[model samples]
Target chain A: MASKASTLETEMPTEPTKRLDTFANPNPDRDYQIHIRIPEFTCLCPKTGQPDFAEMQLVYVPDEACIELKSLKLYIWSYRNEGAFHEAVTNRILDDLVAATIPRYMEITARFNVRGGLYTTVVARHGRPPASLERSDA
Target chain B: MLDEAGRRRGILAQAWPAGQSLSPAAWLRHALQLIALIRRRRPSAEIAAIAVDGTSGTTFLCDTTSGRPLTPVMAYNDGRAGIEARALAARGLAEGPASGPYGGPAKLLWLTRHYGAPSGAGIAAQASWLSGALLGHYGLMDEHNALKLGFDGSWTQILRERPFTVRLPHVVPAGTPLGPLCRTLTRRLGLRSAPLVVAGTTDSTAAFLALGSLPVGCGVSSLGSTLVLKIESPHPISVPEFGIYSHRLPKTWLVGGASNSGAAVLAHYFDRPTLARLSATLPLPTSPRLDYYPLLAPGERFPVSDPRLAPRLSPRPADDRLFLQGLLEGLAAIEARGYALLARYGAPRLQRVVTTGGGATNGAWRAIREQALEVPISLAADRPAAFGAARLARAGWLDTR
Candidate 1:
């Protein structure tokens, strides 16, 4: 019976923050998957200092705690001005999210825009989904 | 009108009509509008004096006797007199202000050529004509406006040597009292009495006067759409190659230049709300080391006067806040370079900087500028050019008495 304002007040951070937040999972006993599509991820290219834009897909299965959506968004925004290679940034994101939520399984797939006539996609993962929840999409 | 202590008793402003062409009738209308507003707000108030300040180089030809415009205004930024400017430079007026296409003399030449120089037509700076309209007199222009019109104290020697067939206005120092406001305007606007119409100055000089007074070596950086840096110097310095010139003040020279980079480029990317929000979030000591020359287009004046110079705003970072910081840093660097150039050209070394215009309100930008300038920075008085004009009017009225 949460009011819309009350829900938003509880959920959204007052300002952009780099610290990711987590809440105890509502249904920790269940084996459901959480899929997040971040369409506006950006970071600087390490060598050239030019911007590199990418779309990221994060899929994870919760163990006991769930990553807070708004905090995760802000966490992703923190890398916007940082210079990092595509492979490195994707792995770093996966590591940070895994460390925060301590999920049973997590994966980050980043598809970057074309540069110098080449498009790059980097995929990084931690742990594995339970055998019963395994899928070919990965 | 301001009190003896220089505090405003009343103030009003009217927006100029939107157009490329300047209209004398519009100027009169706006003046009347301001007068009526003042009368409405403070019926008991007695306006003692009035003055006008206009863009330094904007000028047009007007009938000598009738005070009617003979040609459209050549705006301060208009550059249609390139050939005439080059011709003047070829004749050895190269180092003077009048050799620029946007300067008053070159534009006057262009007007004469296209409009067919008629007899009884005299040139008028925007401020001169507006002031004359109030006094029912024409042909008396202040020295600040007259500078760009080839008058440095005396009509520039070259102009005196080859004199134009077109008449030149009698130049007076700024704050000179011309006469009383015409009886017709006094009655039409319902003033208690005719106030003295003082000879005014160029707008930048008016802005400087708004700061009350500053010692030599104090610089005023106007962070408007373009960055203009003016410093008070003991002696005149003129370096036309760097697009630098000096306007003669009562006791000192106001030396400066304008650059193409400033808050306009920030506006190109961020609106007010976004700018404020991003500005607040910007980390202190916000040097991203992005060497961006954030020009609106490919030309620069002052510090680097190359007409074909391209803007250098590449390697833009992904974060909006970081990009904003980079732009601010670039502007601060340009301002520093401007002061350095002025000093190199024999102007006084800047001891302090007072910031004016829209960008003055930005705290983050101010911090960045202080770091770059290596001088104490302060905000200007929250007064417009009109306030400075009122100060001039007060001085002129007192002098006449």
Candidate 2:
């Protein structure tokens, strides 16, 4: 009979990581969109060192590679204790994603919660959408 | 709660729910659950009083008029107020319990700056807020919890000197009766009568009280998520640089410091069952000889109070059992150094160490700790912090009669 402890040793989750990971896109020949929503994004305020929370929406059209889900989650978690402004952090996420996947079109929108009677939202974009996608939307 | 003859009638323990922040709603839910469980188990038993103990520096803002939470809880280990702590220190408020980023004063400043203090805003500790919730009022705070809020037997002076805009709680001694539980709770919980709500100490202090009695030279090591070391001393000691401070008791002062290294570091790498299994197979004569300072993150609080201290878990060995031994040995070494540091800072020399918390049950770890500490290690008779809170409740109820 196998003990529960012995069984659990082999099923442990991987440690959190800071590096973004990607895999080869399944349909690189065709142009399609991917939307990822991270509801539990949290970072620290650069000035006061207090925690700042946001809901991140990432929309991109993959070219040669696509971002891996678990790796993206870990990458986001790596910033839990880091201190950065909303604008800088939002732009940095888009930049990192673009660098990892080299997507044809990538956009990141961060909706930060209200702090001191002010709500902050930052949007960053990389590359341009294809004319075909614009025409389809129209 | 314990009866007059000091025999336990009923007891219950509940873990904090997963993915739940330490908010007022979560606290009330747990409190009600525990009360209901105890009542169901011992229906005929008459409850006399209730006291609540929480982490020493855990605090949040609340509305004074409505007793409503206005901000999220700043946990005891939250180090986001480093800037505010430094600012306070620069203003010559350095030599007290509230001198670090984890202190209540810094958290309050951070909350005020970020949340914007309203007209009826006030600060509340976990124990105070819970007790107030029971009493339908919210201004009272125990002295032990207030210690980290810069309360040194003088709230008026502290308020006059500091630049806080929120209303500070009225601090009282532990075991002091605040009031009877509100009638609504009695009816809702189906209790025969409202129990007196007693002021409670911090969780660690409450644990200290659970120890039946200890001599001046005796020490207690709490191996919970963090390594907390407290020794009974004739005089209070304060060393803010090393994160050492003293909590006042009726007869003696408990001088101690907490380390960032403890069982939580092990929990990061292995589950509880895995830890127990691996610990059973480790060689007991000597440690794996890996000089590792295990930390979950980059900061340390005691024995070395550098906020930027990096963990030294490198020079990896392939064997998981060896690695577990190394981590256990590292924690034991930290415990030794913590006691040594406390002694260096005017605390009483440790004659014996009474161990408490989850790690106390590990015989292998205990043997290693005894070897490192050079003192006899004994497991506490009662390990739960609630038992101590119940003791406080019993004492307060007796005094009133």
Candidate 3:
């Protein structure tokens, strides 16, 4: 059970707990992560209340704060009851991640298989080495 | 964002509250959205510290006394500006960009001819309007966006030349302090008071911020429907033949030009469904059947200055797929030509390009662009201008202090 804090709201299914294989200190003291997954991941449209099927694999590194999987799971679950276009959903997730965990290096790529006769894969990444990237002056 | 024709454009950055189009209130609404987002992230943020950068050249009519915008802004794309453009050209006062039509002079001319635009409190680009709205004083335009309007950022002229005698906005370099938003707005907009509104910039300039700092030759390709290429320069290169603009980089100029051809043509034949079903059949040829000049419903600029232009496909393919693939090849080739143009204008010859837009996401498209341009072209690593603006806001606030 997640330590429910009054300041933050999170929902976790209580039917039958499926132990998630997760951990910390993977980077020792540095900000980095390497996630391993087995395909199947799903959610529902926030508006139509229809299921939005997707297979996702995420790998992120943090600077200030790292994402909590259970919380992230609930967040993703929340999307199941909401509705949004794919583009909007993808960006909204990225924005939420960035806001939730101030990561130093992060990359999220959504590779949606064929849908409505079109295949769309959207990716957004951000990373800043301690100093500004060479040529930030332009 | 780039248009279907691949023209890199600045965002209006104003709120579209249902049916509202052009007005100071709309501009303020947009600013409020930014403020709300920022406040949610940085609760104690200051107010007076906002500077608004908007789409350059798009003109709006504003009322003086009440500080309201006139209904239905005479748009930048309105061809009605042609008379003014012609008048300026006839008087040897007009300059042309790589592509024809949709320029500041043309829009302004359209304003004069159609509206008989009377001198209001002021007239300026989308950025200036927002800046004026934020500060309550209609006295500024960031120098970054005024170059297209005949306002000189170097000597900061127009005060003398009275270019067009159209009251232009006060030009400030990006990041300049515009003081705080009035306490009235701060309280009304929820929170954050006395925050500094740093002189905001054009969406392109903010995009440049997303590109990181400027040096020379560092070009960003906005590969949307319309392809727009902008590169930083150490000096001004305002040849009308190239469609370049002078900016506030002081030592740098932005070499930009639009493509009269873009995705609209591709969309004409293939919708999202057809494209998915047929990516592989788009011809295996490394070159085009005919050296193509891709265009849409109208004529082209850049390669041709003729305005009454019509979209044409040569060596017409026997099938829709063949033609589209051929069209893609031709556009890819033009992407190369655009880069070559930037190089010719003395922007540090782009060795690699960062792209953001619909076209850039297509793997096959990226391959074609990379092969034709003979350079590594990568999609932007972040979101669009909003990311750029957010990054700018974070860095700018730090710099101003």
Off by more than 4 A, model 1: A1-138, B19-21, B93-96, B157-163, B190-192, B283-288
List, residue by residue over B1-401, the lDDT tens digit for candidate 3: 22111112223343477665555566667667866776665555343345555665566555543456543465545556555566556665445431123556556545544555455635566776676666666667677666656556442232234344455556677666676676677677776456656666777666655444422344567766676777767776665654455455534566666676777677777898787556665446554466666787665555344566776678786776667667777788877787786667666777556565677656567666766776545444444564344444444566665
Clashes of 1: 0
- lDDT values for all models: 0.81, 0.81, 0.57
Pairs that collide, model 1: none
Query: By TM-score, is 1 or 3 better?
Result: 1
- Interface root-mean-square deviation (Å) of every model: 27.3, 28.9, 16.4
Top candidate, metric DockQ: 3
TM-score of 2: 0.67
TM-score of 3: 0.67
List model 1 lDDT by residue over B317-377, tens digit each.
8988888988998999999999999999899888667678999878789878878898656
State the DockQ of every prediction. Answer: 0.01, 0.01, 0.02
User: Candidate 2's residue-wise lDDT over B273-380, tens digit each?
Assistant: 999998898655654589999999998878888878999997778878888888888999999998998898788877567777888778678767867887656555
Docking class for model 3 is incorrect
The 10-residue segment with the lowest total lDDT in model 1 chain A? A13-22
- Deviation in angstroms for A11 in model 1? 30
TM-scores, all models, native as reference: 0.69, 0.67, 0.67
Candidate with best lDDT: 1
Candidate 2: the clashing residue pairs are: none
A1-138 per-residue lDDT for model 1 (tens digits): 569879888887565444556677776546678999999999999999999999999988775468889888888888889999999888767755664565667888899999999999998877666566874354
TM-score of chain B of each: 0.91, 0.88, 0.83
